[model samples]
Target chain A: MVSQLTRNERQLALVILSALALCGLAMAAIGRDDLIGGHGAFILLASLGMGFVVTSGYYHAEPSDERLAHYYDDPSKVGIVLAMIWVVFGLFIGDWVAWLLVYPEMTFDGGWASFGRLRPIHTTAVIFGFGGNALIATSFHVLQRTSRARLPDQLSPWFVLLGYNLFCLLAVTGYSMGLTQSKEYAEPEWYADIWLVIVWVTYFVLYLRTLARRKEPHIYVANWYYMAFILVVAVLHIVNNLAVPVSIAHAKSYSLFSGVQDAMTQWWYGHNAVAFFLTAGFLGMMYYYLPKKAGRPIFSYRMSIISFWGITFMYMWAGSHHLHYTALPQWVQTLGVTFSVMLLVPSWASAGNALLTLNGAWHKVRDDATLRFMMVAAIFYGLSTFEGSFMAIRPVNALSHYTDWTVGHVHAGALGWVALITFGSFYSVVPWLWKRERMYSAKLVELHFWLALAGTIIYVFAMWNSGIIQGLMWRTYNDSGTLAYSFVDSLIAMRPYYIARAIGGLLFLIGAAVGFYNIWMTARGALEESPTNADRPAAVPVAARTIEAGE
Target chain B: MDIDHNIAVVVAKSFGLFYLIALSIGVLVYVYWPSNGKRFDDAAKNVIHDEDAPWH
Candidate 1:
């Protein structure tokens, strides 16, 4: 079925389907003695599901002559194509690292490698590679549409893509070789960090040039958010990653700060990296696609600006919140806590604006999986922000800190907020890019949504409970004030939550696989396949109508 | 002790002065309204009128 599709689309489908098949076979072969292997299988299947959804969306429709004409003149496609390649390659590297971690015995060396190496590899691939590609691709497309201007110096966009992937490669290779500064977020060696800095500066320049040449009168709110993300993230990355390389040959570096100061600085980078890269960037996506998908103006432009500034100023201060009860100065902790509390207002402002933007289109939330994903993501963003601010309070941190609760909070934002929005943007754009009328099956999309949602809920709630319980138990004092529970006892108690969390991951992965299948069949099915060597065009019925509407 | 105390006092005063100046600038910018409703309208009109203007 996948063979009938285009090269990129076909390979993507094959990877996913093969992954799913591997999981199924593994499950049958290894009947549950060790669930670890089974869990790995589930992850592969889910990865495939993601690929399927993306490819199917890409191949659903044919580009019209006008759309093709625009492509003929521009180099943005070169960047886009490169971006796609980097994401695929990144996925493979991430998988290799993760696979090695999951089955350490399978390796030649029975060495126990920490998740520290694999975690960054997997995260950077999915977040920076996949999510970053989606952002750049969609931003290029949307900027063109809103500006009524062709992308500037198409070669530059390609440079951005190539340079970015090169940086990813450098980072991953360096990480595997054990060249790191040991920062949770800024783990990349100095050389890789330098590479990223160069690539990012180019991206910023390209974006600004394009904006300058826009034919539109007012810059869209999306541009504001995107630009802010770019600017603020650049500052954060530079400030936090100030380190000197040990030597050119080895991927070793030392941070400027030491001990607690380093931890504080790292979290400062870490949290704001979340704020700007994940939250701000996705908000930019939401601002554009939500309105475009709903076919309505944003609820209030004023609200957007207010939220934008509020988030920009407020989120920076909230980073210290991660240090809650740490020895990072009481005054600093108070600053973090206070700013975190203040962040809720801006967060809710964005969420409310997005929700209210769908004032009359609420019904579509039932029918349109894309809109539904965005809506749910918005809701989760609010929930995560509230939970984060609350956790920042020293009192609450006393119960939630260093527990699975923190993990739950992170996933609520990462899986629910970031992933959902990314998926929605893909759903909303791939059809336009592919020139398809609509997705092959809305039902599959809906299934994917529910499966992931259920998975997220179970996963988050289980962890939250487990974490708080553990925190409480650890702090609980007997009348004699002996340690309330041994560390081993806490570990035993956490087993149930881990099992539940894994199960949640399984369901989510299964949902993703279903989505993948739907997308694959959509691209490879009879309607998509060309009978003759006609060099068939992409099928975009709705965009055609929109063109007609313009006429 | 006397030298250290003097240095600390000098540093504090300098920091205080810098912050005050920065705050005033922020306040001034907040109050300033360079573009009114009419000016914004005129700018939009100008862009619309120049239909053949090159973009990019």
Candidate 2:
């Protein structure tokens, strides 16, 4: 990867790394009395390690000018590999936590091994660590293809990818060390959030620059979704994380918003973290990759517009749904519920548009496990969105809010919609990226499909059963009007379901491991070489015919 | 800036209702404008490419 850059670019990379190391050193020196010092040491060591690697490759001959004729994909390649690593770590930890729910003794005496710390680690690792990397990687690939332009520069993309991963690294490590703002999904403290903002701004700028250089007359819908995801997330992160740190050295900070306002601000940030980050970003992926894989265009350009804009406009109001029945004003909760319900139109429009786009290629979906991952993903997307809209209603939220049903609802989207689609896109793109004819084993892809599907079903079902039971038990009244069931009774009831959920998670983790192996082997040229021209994006001459969504 | 609760409620609800309705109508009109079929077709076909490279 370093050899692809010119000597000057390498020097620039070295300088950037050195600057980062200096920042790390400053943090370590100033915060030596606090936990931030340990994070500082980690950042310093990571930067130095990367700098040395760059130094080793500095003297290699620069890539030919021909490099300019190709998309800058080195960053995307690295992003995919990093995503796979995080998925495994996240899934393993998730299952470990699930098992701990059943057997409370399944933990070390260490504070980090406690359920509270490990739970956030699992959430952050999978959502931000795995899901974030996939979005960044695929967004780069899709942006180039749809725009028909190379990225404006190489170094910036690398900076965005590496920098974002560093944020993820800091977050996972910091959580274990008891560093947090205690803001649900927005858990990372002030400094790490600041670093993410810097990285994110660079990403947004890079995207816009590439879009400005597009050969197409109109911006693709996928780019629109990506732009929304990038822009709104910045707004959410900045506004919600407005805090005054107790000290630069200390990891503790007081939020700018206090009381009910803090609760409102948090969900506004939290739910949109779901909206823009999870939904919009992956919808963008589906818009591009799903159609391309099926050799179809979008089902309706008209519906794409409706869905894209409708989602952007409506999702902001729905955040208050997360704050339902809380100290938040009644009107705000009502507004959230109304918008949450209204969001179903756009959500289903996108989902239906994707499914309809697959009409001509249903046979291909049937035969191809890669396409099946996406097909199920769209179904899950539709299913989960409907479920989400319903769950946001006041009566429903009364039962589901604190229950495991909420967990089931989230995984329906996270595992079934987000992850399945990511894996699907990866299966298709990995072989293409490596310029291979196909994966190392089609059978393994098929195996992976079943494993992931079965795992998701089991996990979601187990949660649903436990969640509803827990909700019912909590609300049940005896003749005297007191609750019929104790919290411990509910806990005892959840034991079997917890074990099932862990087993399900284990299967999902195993599937990801198989996927990584297949991807690795393909990248290493383990497969017998075949004419990969048919699957190549360069195969079809566009001037001869435009591929419609369906006949 | 210092509107009463009733005024604030009316303002918020009215603006939200009008905004969503206007957006829906505007999008429907633009998408269904009969003359833009070819353009939408072209946009949808953006990924059906001869080369995904920087196009030498």
Top-scoring candidate (lDDT): 2
Please provide, for model 2 over A125-214, each residue's C-alpha lDDT reduced to its tens digit, 9 standing for 90 to 100: 999999999999999999988888899877889989999999999999999988889999899999899999999999999999999898
Best by DockQ: 2
**Worst ten in a row by lDDT for model 2 chain A:** A528-537
CA shift of A383, model 1, Å: 0.8
Report the lDDT of model 2 for residue A473. 92
Candidate 2 chain B TM?
Answer: 0.68
Q: After superposition, how far is residue A307 of candidate 1 from its true place, in Å?
A: 0.5
Candidate 1 per-residue lDDT over residues A328-429, each given as its tens digit: 767668878887898888799899988998889989887788899999999999899889889989898878888879989988997789778866776676
TM-score of chain B of each: 0.42, 0.68
Q: What interface RMSD do all candidates show, one decimal each?
A: 7.0, 1.7
Positional deviation of residue A257's Cα in model 1 after best superposition, in angstroms:
1.9
- Across residues B1-56, which tens digit of lDDT does each residue of candidate 2 receive? 77776886897889878987998899889888999888889989867654557643
